[model samples]
Target: MRASDPAIRSALDHVILIKAHLLQLRESLTALEDVRHSPRGVVLIRRCMLDVRMVFEELMLLSVSAHGEAGDRVEQSLRKKHRADLKIRGLNELNPNFFPDAIDLVASDEPGVAGRFTSVCEPYLTVEQAKRIYFRSDQLLHASRIFMSTEDFEAHRGELIEFYGLTERLLRTFEIDISGTGFMVLGHLNLDDDAMPQVFEAQTS
Candidate 1:
């Protein structure tokens, strides 16, 4: 069987569902982008952040299901009876730190290996950014904290943009054929640069 074989039906389903969810999320982000000039933009920004957090959660689920030893557990958790259990498992399994493990898996002594892997895997958002977004999204979603200054709003808005970019990249990079859009290079296939996200260095003072 080829690496592109459909033998892993559950993973395929998960990818499709995640893509669909991402389409919903893109709509939300586009709405936020349009109304960003208004004062009400803050609220929309918050909603986008929440959606980003959700997308991140689903990405983690896909990561574990696709790459972890507990892949079978991930499959079980997808069923109706196991959803609650899956929530707990997701918390532990989807930790963004899993990126390092993924890096390790792709580690090689080849000169360009590190650069290529970092470009593809860690791409835009850092692990720290992921955690911060998840945390802040939680605070905003539950109304556990309420302080929205202009600076804070700008910061969150920037983060939301970055989050949006990262999510889009992940979907495109690891996407499967069932979704009708994806960038995974089949055996002997070349990666299409236009299909990949444009890389930009984050400015830091």
Candidate 2:
């Protein structure tokens, strides 16, 4: 699809919002280190899980928004259901091509290079990975432990960190193949500077 197409623009807007939530998730994960044994640690951990949930929710919404009228029916059905697994499955059935198979990071050969660039593709986030993370996050979010102990927090620390890493890779640079003829790439030019999200376009077979 063309960059100016309403569907593409709407998808870009979703990317921007998802990026903001990802930044917040990163902050929460980083803050967990100093207070992992305290009450504040539990709060941060929960916040991280919440952020993940929100990210997946937005992703589903983005998919629905891109499909027009058919998408509206799916959205309504989604409203009636509250299960993450089912929601993911529903979205997949609606459009299996909604999620990209891998992320593409493009770099210039030299400082002044204009047209000379190379892209490295990494298969980090896939539908299965997303489902795993989403399910785990939901479980942790609704766990029975009201005030989790230090050992309990430690037990889940590695999993949470892994989830964060996977999520970061997914958002840092990825493309969504909307159809057979075109795809959209979304990423940041300079993450350190908090630059605005940028979207690029390319044609495919």
Candidate 3:
């Protein structure tokens, strides 16, 4: 895509960088299939850390679209924290994936934990909703944990299993190994098996 606005162009550059970082993350993770306990994935993720920030910079400048209020939080986190933290606390606030907020649950459970999460997330979930919310680095990291979950969630969940078993050691590996590999797999993938398209549409878009 081409643009006449310098800021918008800059934003696209950041988006391109984000895409590259994600690709690298995938490559590193996939590399661990044969190499046992490889730190390669973590290393790649570290490199992409900066790229993640760039994406947010561009997104906010462009303001080209919206993923609801949650997106605003992601943008703020990028401004306040380093790229590395984005994976830890920025990911969740920016990208909730399937985790819906208040607007999503207004019709379902009104007095449950899910409802609570949604409620806090709502009024601010959509760009049209609250207009803004406090975005923090921790939220990004917390969000990434879920955002980068493995392909087969049902088989090995909450086991703290990273990439095959790396989830348990995410701090050291930057994990969520799906390629049956180690951190060398780089921690990026598109498929959210059995997930609704809307779950990841914001990120993919």
Candidate 4:
């Protein structure tokens, strides 16, 4: 029998709906380019682009912000619900720090970390900037803390990755003339060389 939770179905529906809009926008833009010679066509195309951008920016924000919206009972139920969050099961109970150390290489059945990592990044990126986002491991874990339930974490994980991928694709589609998009990546850095290799950096570069 198929698992049929209304909440799960709703979440899936939302993601699918969001992706469908993106597909429509892509199609519309492709269609728009063909009609570029007409002033009315250009205006309409510009409007569509604006609308798509606005809609997706809101979506990306929603995807990230919704992570911990499930409430404290859900968040603090780790011991009682061992399999509730896949991260908890995968996490080393004997050695609690195991998950933090392996976060960089860990891949769940769903895109848990990947999605969280992706959503936190800005859409427009230069070559160097893109590298920073790819390496933003620490921030991803910090953000994933809210996904207490394995079901919830796995369920919405792909959306985060999609959000990040959307940014890259949007930049490509528009040739993103980002002369001054005023976007920057912020991360922590370790300052103490004598602190030990085990310590994380203490600065954002």
Candidate 1 displacement at residue 11 in angstroms: 1.9
Residues 46-130, model 1: lDDT tens digits: 6676566666555455444434445555445544432333444454553333331111124568876562233354665555666
Worst 10 residues of 2 by lDDT: 180-189
Better-scoring candidate (TM-score), 1 or 2:
2
Q: All candidates' TM-scores?
A: 0.53, 0.77, 0.29, 0.29
lDDT of 1 at 89: 45
Worst 10 residues of 3 by lDDT: 196-205
Q: What is the C-alpha lDDT of each candidate?
A: 0.49, 0.65, 0.30, 0.31
Collision count of model 3: 43
Winner on lDDT (1 vs 2)? 2
**Residues 46-133, candidate 4, lDDT per residue (tens digit)?**
4444334333322222222222332122234323443323423322232222111101122445745342222223344333332233
Off by over 4 Å in 3: 1-4, 38-205
Query: TM-score of model 4 relative to the true fold?
Result: 0.29
TM-score of 2: 0.77
In model 4, how large is the Cα lDDT of residue 199? 17
Worst 10 residues of 4 by lDDT: 175-184
Candidate 1: residue pairs that collide: none
Give me the candidate number with maximum lDDT. 2
- 182: Cα error in model 3, Å: 42
Question: Candidate 4, which segments miss by more than 4 Å at Cα?
Answer: 1-5, 50-54, 57-205
lDDT of 4 at 43: 47
